[model samples]
Target: MAGILVYAEVRNGAVRKASLEAVSEAARLTKELGGSVSAVLVGAAPANAGEVLGKAGASEVIALAGPKFTQYSGDGYAAAIHKVAAQMQPTAIFVASTPQGKDLAPQVAVLTHAGVASDCVGFTVAGGKLLAKRPVYAGKATLTVKAAESLLVATLRPNVFAQTDAGAPVAVTTREAGEVSLRAVVKEVLAAVANKLDVTEAPVVVSGGRGMKGPEHWGLLEALATAFGNAAVGASRAVVDAGWRPHDEQVGQTGKTVSPTLYIACGISGAIQHLAGMSSSRVIVAINKDPEAPIFKVADYGIVGDVFEVLPVLTEEVRRLRAAS
Candidate 1:
């Protein structure tokens, strides 16, 4: 039986950062439990992706190859993963809680009759059973759950776990994707891979709130994000609700909950609804003029000044810092 199976997420012919974190997180748990970490890559693992997974701590990478499985099909992915799970009979299975990962994990869980946990923030082993820790009630509470199945399945929250690369060597094995067939097929798969930083993978994020005024002023936010080099741009629920940004960029209870190392909230008031999303960030910097703003309560650092004025200065400072480095 395999020890732990991590679903390696690939996007647009490359390895997704969430998949790297998933394997790294799994490796930690597996080490704690005296087990192994095995990764599964569907839809023809891209070149070097298997190696990347290994570096993230996969003891073995099963790379499923073929064009038929190129696009993410729920049924096809479930069948493919089911095939591996049956053979591996792992103690735990980890999948990223992405749009695609969410769809596939549940289907595989049903097929394997494995208990499933979604958006687990933490995990551990006790009495040979896996325990998952997750937030609930819009991050108002935390819950610990134990799956009854021998093969435990969970969807890992992206960016929730800090990635620690152990540098495991690559060991890639291939399986034909044709072995798994879907009842439905996606006719086209297209992506715009340029000019966007994936927030789930970013170590630092600069998010804007209603203080930005309008979408036209979004250029300031973009410049700030660019100043940080790898930082992603996020939006408050108010901004999203106002159609100032896409739902995917929303960071709140009703949106994407992020746990980056650094979270910069510009013009955000830190409402409970919004705090539900980013309160877990390691270091929060609030750039709001209001000293009484609730966000300052949770912020590790606060700049009591107008964001409109502060942001431009901050952007220049970050630019200078990066240039210096």
Candidate 2:
């Protein structure tokens, strides 16, 4: 009931960026909470993870190492996190709002008898208590909520919180998972195309809608994303419904919510549902033939032009700029 506990997620033996953001935010909150930050890394996290977490503001790193914790099973991961939270007895628990985190937060909350807040974009400490701000009504509005329970668990949206450097590296305390009864087991993980970024995690996302006409024309969108090098290809729900693009790439109310640094909407009319997913993006660029498209309203930059003619020039210009830099 003193410090903040962070569920530091690791992938490929490295900590995910979103988890670091959570830890950094927790560090900032410690001034008001008046306790150290404890980051718990579950499973087969690399040795350097503790150092990385320490630099990211973790006062101490807790390693839950064991064979059962290696692969992520919803039941197993939740059990492990609950055990750590129970032992630490932290005032607040923070988890990244990634796909894994979204599923894990509620389960952990239930185990620890805490109220769970999902996909929070902002936070404030009022009188030594945590207040979470989250998008409600499909991103149409923001609602500030305070958990009635003494222990509060919040899932922070990736890219929403700022990640900053903290103190130097700290000592890592190893812990055992002990015993867990898991109903399901993760035998293996099926990853997407190698090196391809998840839309939710990408820094830049170039999205297409039904205006792309058909799936064959997706190369125009891909070329633009490829030009940026770090950009990911996103699709609107309309295109996914039409089977023009895979559901994984869809960005909308029914799909994945993304808050990348830069979001470029190509040939998208910008339905409210689509806006609900990406309105939180730092900067938005919209391109469409119609000047009055809804996407232009939320866009920081707008290009009223045909996608066919604009995409090639934009791609080449991006490549030229990258080469020059």
Candidate 3:
């Protein structure tokens, strides 16, 4: 039927925002491509998963449940996804450009003999085929790609697409997670901080750089993040390398790429690698003492001041505004 098949990632019995974004994009594309949008849940999905995905525009949801699928096994999950793709033969498969999706997409592509477009930011229909627009060369260039074969596997970048709510409750078909060779199995999944939103998924990111001087100064960034309420704290590569911050908090080409509604860079010099990760942010505000810092080049608003001095005032102002509102 040439329908779009979306891989919906579930974490702690909830649908990940990135997965919802992928389903939403597929739903929009299906309008022009003339097919339905179906989602596949690859783990211990919640019973309401179908309704959640349906609200996100999926017409149907397939749940691959059972003990074997509870823990992530690359080989097992890939085989399961391949099994479904073979049965459905969707023209295009959409997956979120997450750590798991990055590994799963290539394996699925190989099994289905489909070309892959990783970390795609946009999509368009060209000649009845899906064309994916993705950033290349450290986000310096945009490349539009189409699958050579009939099927294409595209990974949609997080926070780049808007998730739309559409359609009614859809039927969810649960299937036993069949047997597959397990090369490596994830024994445990430990989050750095429970209940803390990942920087990639946060609407606002408050990042610190070498200018923070020491780990003790990070409290300023944290205070600011707390003031913003939904903001996540991020660190530059230099800060991570110096061991002042953890690698998970790093935001650069070597770290996690983020496209948030607002990105605040404090004491960051704006290295090209760091810029590559966050240049796509909707609005950027750079705060550095150096007036000549490269971060100013891409910032919508530049503040020339010491972060230590500015952050306290900024945090207080945000608190004041929130209190009044």
Write the candidate numbers in order of decreasing lDDT. Answer: 2, 3, 1
For residues 1-325, what per-residue lDDT tens digits would candidate 1 score against the true structure? 3578998888867777888888898888877676788899886778887678888988888987766775778888888888888888888889998878888899989988999999899897888678999888877788999986777789998877766777766868998755666787767755445657766667898999998788888888889988988899999989999998988889887887788889999998999889888888889999988899999999999999987898899999999988999
How accurate locally, in lDDT, is each candidate?
0.85, 0.90, 0.90
Q: Rank the candidates by TM-score, best first.
A: 2, 3, 1
Model 3 CA lDDT for position 312:
96
Put down candidate 2 lDDT per residue, 210-322, tens digits, no spaces: 88899999999999899999999999998999989889999988999999999999999988999999999999999899999999999999999999999999999999999
TM-score of 3: 0.96
Which 10 consecutive positions of candidate 1 have the poorest summed lDDT? 189-198
- Model 2: number of clashes? 1
Model 1 pairs whose backbones collide: none
Which stretches of candidate 3 lie above 4 Å from their native place?
none
lDDT of 2 at 66: 72
Error of 2 at 18 (Å): 0.8
